[model samples]
Target chain A: MTTAPRLTLPAVTVGDRLPDLPYDVTATTVVLGALASRDWRPMHHDKDFAVDRNGVRDIFLNTPNQAAWFERYLTDWTGPRGRLGRMTFRMKGSVFPGDTMVFTGTVDEVVSDDTGCGWIGVDVTLSVGGDLKTSCHARLALPTTDDDNPWSRSGDRWTP
Target chain B: MTDLSADIEALIGVEQYEEAGEFPVERGYVWSTCSAVENGNPLFWDDDVADALTGGPIAPPTMLSVWFRPHHWAPGRDRVALPLQIHFDLKEALGLPEAVMTENTIVFHDPVRPGDLLTTRQILRSVSPEKTTKLGTGRFWVIEVEYTNQAGALVGVESYTGFGYRRAGSEAGVAP
Candidate 1:
């Protein structure tokens, strides 16, 4: 439904470490993300505007840009079956062009439910050169085994 | 004990609202957003794939923030939307004109379908007192939003956190 349901490892457990993803934050990504989210704030794309008006070194990432990064990380790890339940994050500093962001996380909690789904929590961080830029707490509803599709359920049945 | 704290204190529970009625949910926008992020989730675009689950194409849950977002132009296409109201004013009053959004929490209660006209309201939740972090001393505040479709069905909710801070200095709230 939502995910591809392609490859899944054993049901995740607490303390399981996710793969480390190191990416270069480029000007294209910064600007594209702003456009995609429809966040027209100049600081996200116009370097001159950022430094001249906002007082940052260069054009930087926006909230939706950061959200995209986290979204990709979660879906990539859980494959297509990982349904996002809730996500909470805090921005600590700015992520600028030429910065390499390393994403890492650990499984925080897992709850087995009768609805044939497993609710998962992951605490994650996005850092550049060892300086933390963002921290997030996310809840994902993952299918148990292959047939457990969380997307087909009605709104009244959504899990917490 | 920084002067910013008291100014921020005056803002707790103050709310500002921007309303958009009966908005269209376009497939192109959803496809573009998912494509930009490199998310291959077929549910966003493939009707055959989506039909297998949602009975129709479904928007990515993360797009909840995008739909019903107020454009730079104010409603009725009259003029540029007024400068961000409470958020900008609070930051200015605190003398921390420079601020960053450090936290966001979004919960999806319902799937967004293609062509669903959505409505939403955003509220200013709470503003914390000045706190010192590695970045600097600043105030953290929450903006809560609730989304519903034209049928009056709930779609989702989001709590976005903004941390407005000044550079660290010798002040009591500045982090070392």
Candidate 2:
């Protein structure tokens, strides 16, 4: 399978928009993500437990599941070389089965730190039916040049 | 600090070290996770690609916490009603019936690879006094978990903030 080409620092600009990622949620989607994350909470897989115990409409996506989707969305745009430095997100609502989750993001800043690390700031949102579910702010490291690999930086050279 | 109750105040800055995950990271598990998320990042799927970027085939950075998630059931271990012990503790302490995570911040430090065994230490960062939110009236708390690989190298750190509240009309007013 092919992946997006590696992104270089100079290629990015503030206000650059990432391609929209849309996913159709289903019971299988929720359960699979939970299982993959090793989360065995019934509320993530059992509808009765979710509806009765949790008092939600149905089983919903777990924390790590949503984080996985956010990482997937960001990496899909930056390709493999764009290494994440930090990510912070606030959950506003739940994303349940049958909801169509859309991920939209825009570049907030681009900078080369004193250590020569290239950083890109992004603001992202996960929404369902135009209603917000989560808002995210992420910082990732990109290559300053074709030869520079952000992953190679460590210790004092790397600081998120 | 004055707003925090005595019980909640005592938990701040206390770190709890947890046992290692049951199994080491496995390629099969990693592959399944990638499939589940529909993530086609070659770093997670192709060793050659990953070697070029992250030094070797590495699990997705997002999967750092997945490595330390406790099993739902074991041969001798009792089944847990909740996934997180702190959540249970906070609920019991604050007397809140419902809880939800509001925010999370994670910093990635090291790549987690297949065959790596991971462990975690969690600390109670802070707790808020009773307050009203759209969800209801309750308290807010923040917990931070630090992940480490078998070699004792820090892999990542996650600060999770949650709200434990009672729905409207049920203990709805602010704390007395």
Candidate 3:
């Protein structure tokens, strides 16, 4: 299902903006994503509790849901050849139903790791209704050539 | 009741939770989660697609925290009656009980493949003094969770920050 053009290590630069991704949030997407993340926090699904008790507008998106959106943005752009190495994000605004979350990113830096993997740093922003929902940064590993595959290397050997 | 008087400041380096799931990374959970996130990457569902790349299906890295919940229904770490939220009694001690996660950071070390049982240890990294903000007067804290596999191989580390606040005018400690 990876339809995007596979981006190789040599193709990307430090100022490239990834393809903008748009996702519409509904009650189902919010609840399902929370459940899948094994999150049972009331505010993520219970509208009544979130509004009356928490004073929020409605049932808002949970951390994992936002996290998944960030992951999708990176992997979708990298295609199958790239792998996620690290991700960090800060949630500023709550995302509710009927909100359209737009994900955009710009490559911040590029470096070569010791293990022959190309490391790419991206500064990402998730905005909804002209408001910033989450600001994120991630380091992705890309294969340099057809044979420089990150998938083939396995067995839990990596560092921070 | 009186606000928690316990000296919560003394609990800076507590390991609040060490959690793990009973079963290994199963296909059912992996596929369901991918579907929920709308991640159409074949590496999550199709075996042939994954086998061609990473040798087999792998769990999404975003599910790292999902695999390490509070350990409510597992062995070794059965939901203990831990002191106040954030593991330092600070939330209760300050009369600010409501909490919301404000930020997160995850470092992926390796791919989590099927049949690999995961384990995690959460440590109370830091807790800042009470501060006044638009929401209310609250304290900010950080909890770091380290994940590992069945063979004790390091998997990932997640740092989650939360702000526990009490609305203004609701309590005396709240800011106007």
Candidate 4:
């Protein structure tokens, strides 16, 4: 397995761009994801149903799938010490099994909490073939010092 | 067919709550599901990689959806309704000839991590009887579910629009 890049809290700030992560949405992939999520929605698994009934040419990506992509993009940048506070996205189009989705984002703002921890806000987007499929804004909290890392200690409570 | 419409109406526009069983953040489950969906990332499976990047054990975004599985109508019932999967099967069983998912949306207010017990409340936002093609007749129903942790913090809200279709010329007296 490839070693993931070293992610540090202080190193990230406003204007940092998350690396583009690529994924292929396939029939087996969509079906398995839907089954794992227990969505049982036909457009996610049944190509015929999607095309014949919904006028979609192929199986489409589900809401959870899009949310996952957004999370992946942010986590790659923030590392573990960073805690996701909130994320909201609006899906604009359907992503099919054959479509390649690229997840990317940019840090838009940063703030300090009362506990002296760092909080960063980001704007994220998912695109296929140069068309924006989804866009989101997210907030995350990170520790200023390694010792202050929230996830470092046991029984540390996470707050939104 | 029972007129669940009234029951549905009473439930509609009014929020009804249900609590889900506790679920651990299982890295294996996340990896398997991501792989099945062709999402290849060491962060989902390799703790070392995830720890190196995030500083702790973390779940993928798709992991939030997985919680919906292993849930049954009754508490403690492990029977999998596999709602999305069953919709497909229901199409086949009813011989309705066709069915489709028109839209779906999920809003995340908080991150769902390991060791979190999720409580969900669902509200039938709306139901609209609609027109369809010759293969069958159908209706569109919108349901929104809010998921909160044991601490009563809202985690996420998932909204789904589902279509149920019946086979042409086969809809006189069949049970829904």
Best by TM-score: 2
TM agreement with the true structure for every prediction: 0.80, 0.91, 0.83, 0.62
Clashes of each: 5, 0, 0, 12
Q: Write candidate 1's Cα lDDT for A13-124 as tens digits.
A: 7899989989887898788888887788889888999999989899998877678778888888876557788988888888998999899999998886665556888999
| Per-residue lDDT over B81-124 for candidate 4, one digit per residue giving the tens place of the 0 to 100 score | 44244344334443345555666555555555666777776676
Tell me the DockQ of each model, to 2 decimals.
Answer: 0.47, 0.68, 0.54, 0.20
Better of 1 and 3 by lDDT: 3
Candidate that beats the other on DockQ, 1 or 4, i.e. the better one: 1
Candidates 2 and 4, the one with greater TM-score: 2
Candidate 3, pairs of clashing residues:
none
lDDT of 4 by residue, A1-160 (tens): 3442235457777898877878876777677766666566688888899999889899887776666656656766665455566666666787887888887888898777555556788888888999998887787767666555544322224444
Q: Where does candidate 3 stray beyond 4 Å?
A: A1-5, A152-157, B1-16, B70-88, B93-98, B129-138, B164-176
Compose the digit string of candidate 3's lDDT tens values, residues B17-126: 56565567777767777787777776776677677777777888877767654434556754553312353355555667567777778988877888898987777777
In model 1, how large is the Cα lDDT of residue A16? 92
Q: Considering only N, C-alpha and C atoms within 3 Å, which residue pairs clash in candidate 1?
A: A3-A80, A89-B103, A90-B102, A90-B103, A91-B102
- Model 2 RMSD, rounded to 1 decimal: 2.9
Q: Report the error of model 1 at residue B39, Å.
A: 1.4
Give candidate 2's error at residue B158 in angstroms.
0.7
> Model 3: how far is A1 from its true place, Å?
11
